[model samples]
Target: MTIYGSALIVFVLMALPLYGLLLTSFQPEAVIRSRDVQFLPATLYLDHFRSVLAPGHIVPIREGIWNSVVVSTLTAAVCLIVALPAAYALSRLRLPGKNLMLGAMVSVYFLPTTIFLIPMFVLFVSWGIDDTFFSLVLAYAGFILPFEVWILKTFIDRLPREVEDAARMDGCTHLQVMRHILLPLVRPGILAGFIFAFILSWTEFLTPLIFTSDIKISTVALGMFRSTIDIQVGQQAAAAVLTLLPVALLMIVFQRLITQVLMAGADR
Candidate 1:
């Protein structure tokens, strides 16, 4: 009961802001600007959503959404493609200095991401891909790959080697075993990694802010909702709610698997 109460408290604390944001998104601009704060609006307003989708807006929300979808999808795919094989090697194969390499990867995850921003931006500039989606995907995938590798490795480590051994005895090669057996069993971990990679890439702002000028992802575009003289609170709130939908939906759908993966990682 104590633990359940504590969990409920934590959920409310975290959800209060989201609830307020959702309410504000549906309130009129006039209600938003009013001195009185209404937890419940008198009437639902659709103008904010319309304004957000309206053409010739200062923030190209449509384009931003498109860019975010493409970049996040690409980043997730790249991380999975690279992480799976790397994880299999790390977990299964006998490799020298494997522990050292794993420690180094974890260390990278701990280091402040800010330190890499300038150097990465400069590197991209030198490579002449500074303002391109390619740069955004590359940067996001680089930062996220280590975590993906660790997640997949954790899942792979938990699997029984007897399965792989059996496959090998039946003339199945490593590639065949991975394709037919390992991948199927580790599907949960793979889904978790892909969803996480997509979420991280979708929510990432700094890399996109530095790497691209004209190409704005939803995160950067949301930041553009503010200015010195005036802030578009209504539209911003609507956009925030909209931008949050995909992630929210993903979490709702995969909450059980994600929680299991996280618990497993914590145990490890």
Candidate 2:
């Protein structure tokens, strides 16, 4: 009873903001701006949506969405490519100071994003890669790779070494063993890591804000709802609601996989 009650309370706390955001997105701008607090709209008004979705609107929402998809997909792919081999090594090989290396990697993941921002920006500038999709992908993948390594390593550790040993005894090369034997076994972890890396890249604001000027993704584009003169409350709410749709859809479809991955990590 206590657990159920606590869960319900937690759900409401998390959901209330979403409810308000959704509600405001549909309410007329006047109702939104008025002093009176409205929990429910007297009538649904969709000018907010029309305005935001319209071409030549203040925000380049359409372009932003496409850019976000490209950046996020590339980042996830890069992270996975690097993480698989790194995870395989950490799981299968014995090395001097392996534990220390793992600890250092995890510690790096915990460091605040701001710590890397200026340094990464300057480095990218030196390389003449700033303000490009490749730069964002590089930065995002670097940040996400450590977590991906840890997740894939957890999945790899759970597997039996005998399978690989048997494959080797049958004369399978290390690469072939990983491809034919281990890869199929660890698909869930790979997917989880990829999804998470994608999510992180999609929602990242500060890094993109600092790194790119002409190349704006959806999260940065959403900031167009404000200016020196006014804040378009209704349009901003509408944009916010739209910004979450992709992530919300992802959560709905992959909720179980995400839950399982998180539980596995926690249990480990």
Candidate 3:
């Protein structure tokens, strides 16, 4: 196919779902209830958005958004702080049982998250962190750490050792080398890991559902579940759209970094 044709095909593939989401967000309940599905709404309705954004409805929605943001941010920060050094050590330093330790770290990803929910909940309660943002952040960090470490290790392994050696020759400590030389080189990996951690934490449902009964700690994913006996499909759709905004914005803002990370990995 021609270049323009290929571009059009790719655009269609990406645009359709976004178009559907936009259309659904504007659709009224009656139009949604109609037996035949339509691409265009009969009448545009802002009620769902207004209702969701209004003070009465805003409380749960805002709380959920805030909870998600806080948890995701902390998860990303903690994952980077811990993973970067560990990945550097694994990639750059020679240590006994390094393979075994790397294997163990990778093994953590093999176990299903569901298996740990009950134990995690119990531990959180025992620590008096249950139903708190700290608990959620810690859980998210643990959940994403293995993958972050693996990805970062790959990137760090690809880095030239000469720079690190030079830093060390300059009388730099291990921490200094990591801070000044290693980190700047592996920024794309760190960005990729941060995005992954944030997305995982933001969309996590099971842990939040199990640990938080209070509306205060509820995430957007959890808040999306609160529907009356008679479901409000339009409102739910609106909520889903709004919940997606931050994630979408994140992707847009970091699109260059994400693209570079993917390209770098692919080149390897």
Alpha-carbon runs more than 4 Å astray in model 3: 1-18, 41-43, 228-230, 259-268
In model 3, what are the clashing residue pairs, if there are any?
A: none
Summed over model 2, clashes come to 0
For 1-268, candidate 3 gives per-residue lDDT tens digits of 6999999999989998887877877888888877899976677789988787665573367667887888889889999899988888888887999989988977987898888888898888998889888888888888888878878988888789998998799899998998888888887788788897888788888888888888877888888667322447777777788788888888899898767666765764
Query: In candidate 3, what residue range of length 10 has the lowest lDDT sum?
Result: 224-233
Residues 72-126, candidate 1, lDDT per residue (tens digit)?
A: 9999999999999999999998899998988899789888989999889888889
Q: Please give the clash total of every predicted structure, in order.
A: 0, 0, 0
- Pairs clashing within candidate 1: none
Q: What is the C-alpha local distance difference test score of each model?
A: 0.83, 0.83, 0.82
Q: Roughly what TM-score does model 1 have, to 2 decimal places? A: 0.91
Summarize candidate 2's per-residue lDDT along 103-134 as a digit string, tens digits: 89988999999999999998999999988888
Winner of 1 and 3 under lDDT? 1
Model 2 regions more than 4 Å off: 1-8, 215-229
- Model 3 global lDDT (CA atoms, 0 to 1): 0.82
